[model samples]
Target: MLAACGSADDSAEQPQNQDGETEQQTADQGGKADQEATFPVTETDAVGNEITLEKQPEKIVSMVPSNTEILFAVGAGKAVVAGSDFDDYPEEAQKLEKIGGQEFNVEKIVGLQPDVVFAHESALGVGEEGLQQLRDAGLTVFVVKNATDFDETYGTIQQIGKLTGYSAEAEEIVSGMQDKVDEIKEKAEAVTDKKKVFVETSPAPDIYTPGSGTFMQQFLDIIHGENVAADQQGWVMMDPEEIVNRNPDVIMVMYDYIDTAVEDVYSREGFDAVTAIKEKAVIQVDENITSRTGPRLAEGLEAVAKAVYPEIFGEAEQDEEDQAA
Candidate 1:
């Protein structure tokens, strides 16, 4: 599972055009006023809550990493005043004020006086009461859904864009993401030999893997790789014996923050008998790219494709030759 963290800093500087006006400047000058003209906008959130916005929000707080990424990607970075402890993407998010982690700091958040706050559906498990407190304070709070696939992620971007007055930018971002996914799918269709892959989210002793209906499974399908755990559902803890029995062609480790090593997987007593271990095909993937449902997901897809089929999707031979020179 992705860990919840916080952030601390300031809003990003807006990009300026030839007219010496930044996007934020334009929004402040007239864009927000125009948005307000269409206000009293009503929308349903992921957790089935109806949210009505009477005016454009100038101050925003994002309580989840994915929401923070969406907010920044859709040109609302300047509006974000605080983010969860786990939001560390885009460099800009790192500068926002930290508002606690999976358990939010309700007092601090209320003190910030944000016009809008973004939360995740998953947060309901632990932060629902705090969210209600925000609502009780007469603040507008929106809950983003927990995206299991790329389509839902795109929908999340669209929803956030509409709320933040960046609908056009959100649509453009979605189009770009769709184009990249289509390109990947086209490449995947050309592969004649599919490899069975095992994805490990946690290290041994108690190992965890994503099965059917998870993003990792979808990613494997996109790259023409078979998930060894496809028979299972959701995140399941598998016995080492089960992994040995499956004997995947490739093993992808998804934890980078821990001290776990690829060598550890290769050296496991019974694992050496597996094809992946015997051939030294154990690969490490960035947890954020593979796990976070955000703007950089396409980059994550490209990385997975390359990891699974280096010969086909890896760096060009010409580039390698140039580097050797």
Candidate 2:
């Protein structure tokens, strides 16, 4: 798992002021509002350098898909003024102004004049310079770390909750998710056999699978399934020979590409003999819920658990029916 190494000072726990906002920590000796501060924001990014918000940010801009979901989930949906192109989950997000994709368009983002800018840690490889420019322009640029496992995902929710004055709400969400996860773990504890699985992503030709340090791997483990490519770190391209050798019992198809596999997968001569293909165990999971590390991840985990142990997840089907009725 991609674990955060920084240790928080236990002695630094401070209470919210009479106004309900905790004193924002600062890095400068003068304690100027213009300077940056490293306040304990959340489990992922902690306002690393010396940037202080003028006030608890009223105009937020989410530059990543997961960040947008987190903002909305934590009662900050009304606060979000801008979003990335992929922020299409909550329907409300689609109504917001879009500022380009992960590659970054500084002008588009800057034009929004956001109070706080939420970027992803993964965006560093592509958008770091643009983020830095935003930072240098005195905009509060907050980076949400891409977690590799469940614990990190929990930490992310907790951190976002604290930052957004939704600590109580965030905790409630985390508690609900944790309880579900615990129940799944308990039920699968006695299963002696664990099957290896491979998750196939969309926009083929450049095929990709989740490796060791990813949120997908965590979902696989929660359902007593092992990622066949866990040894490979990050997203990797797998050869047909590798898949044939590992011989995953299950294959996950992102919902967007379900049509691709139903035709393309079966059409392939050699792939038809694969264990998962032969057994017809290929499953479809919502990409919006599973791919992003947000509140809906619990829902995604349930899907994975269902794929692994259909008998245990029979209630899920009933619950869906009840909801529809």
Candidate 3:
């Protein structure tokens, strides 16, 4: 999956009086004004840089899709001035100024003069100098941490919310996400037969699959499905013959880079012997929802549920009921 997701810290600074007085607000305080903070929010970025925002940023730039999604989710979408080339969510993001793709356009960003720019640790390996250049221009650059699971993602949203002076909205978003997760879990637990799933990021020549230590593995666990690649670590290439031997009950394709991704899988030489292929359980999923670790993670989890357990999550079960009637 091209889903190299990264997020922000949860430790947002609040007002510090001599007495260090603080009080938690109630739900009636408009949304959930959970952790109220003062201006000049100072938090350590992913790269160990102490980035301090003097005030709420009126204009912002996001260098990655996940950060862009986070900013929008926290009610700071209107303040966003520009986003990465890949940002296509919330309809409004598509209309924003386009920064470069993998390689960011520092000149365009500098010209925009955003109050703060959100970067990611995943891009630092190759774009470190580019980020430094932004700093040299006297702009505040905050590198969000790499987030793999739901907890880290929630923290990222809340952190952004505090920095942008939208703490209540951020808390509300996280609360809703948690509620959705609980709802999905309750439904998923009823599944009696656990199925084995195989997910591929790419097709054929260079197939990459996420193994242990990834959010996708946890997603499988939540939906009562077993990952055939749980033994491997991170993204690894698996042999086709070994996949045949394992005989997964469902095959999930996570990329749409090619038009015939699912069809190509069906035509694979030895895949026909696999149980998933025989049962026609090979599925193509929306890579964005499943890969992006942001506000929509719960929705993505639902998508996985629909893909793996169609009889329960999708129209398959409804059709069966109608036929029986």
Output the number of the TM-score-best candidate.
1
In model 3, which residue pairs have backbone atoms overlapping below 3 Å? 7-145
Superposed model 2: Cα runs more than 4 Å off: 1-47, 202-205, 255-258, 315-325
- TM-score, candidate 1, is 0.86
Q: Give the range of the ten consecutive residues with the poorest summed lDDT in model 1.
A: 3-12
Assess candidate 2 and give its TM-score to the true structure.
Answer: 0.79
Ranking by TM-score: 1, 3, 2
Clashes of 2: 5
On residues 17-94, what C-alpha lDDT tens digit does candidate 2 reach at each position? 233442221111111222232343433364355444435566888887787776666566767888876677566788
Clashes of 1: 10
RMSD of each: 5.5, 9.3, 8.0
Greater-TM-score candidate between 2 and 3: 3
Give a tens-digit lDDT track for model 3, residues 119-168. 88777777778787888998999988877788988888888878777776
Question: Lowest summed lDDT over 10 consecutive residues: which window, candidate 3?
Answer: 9-18
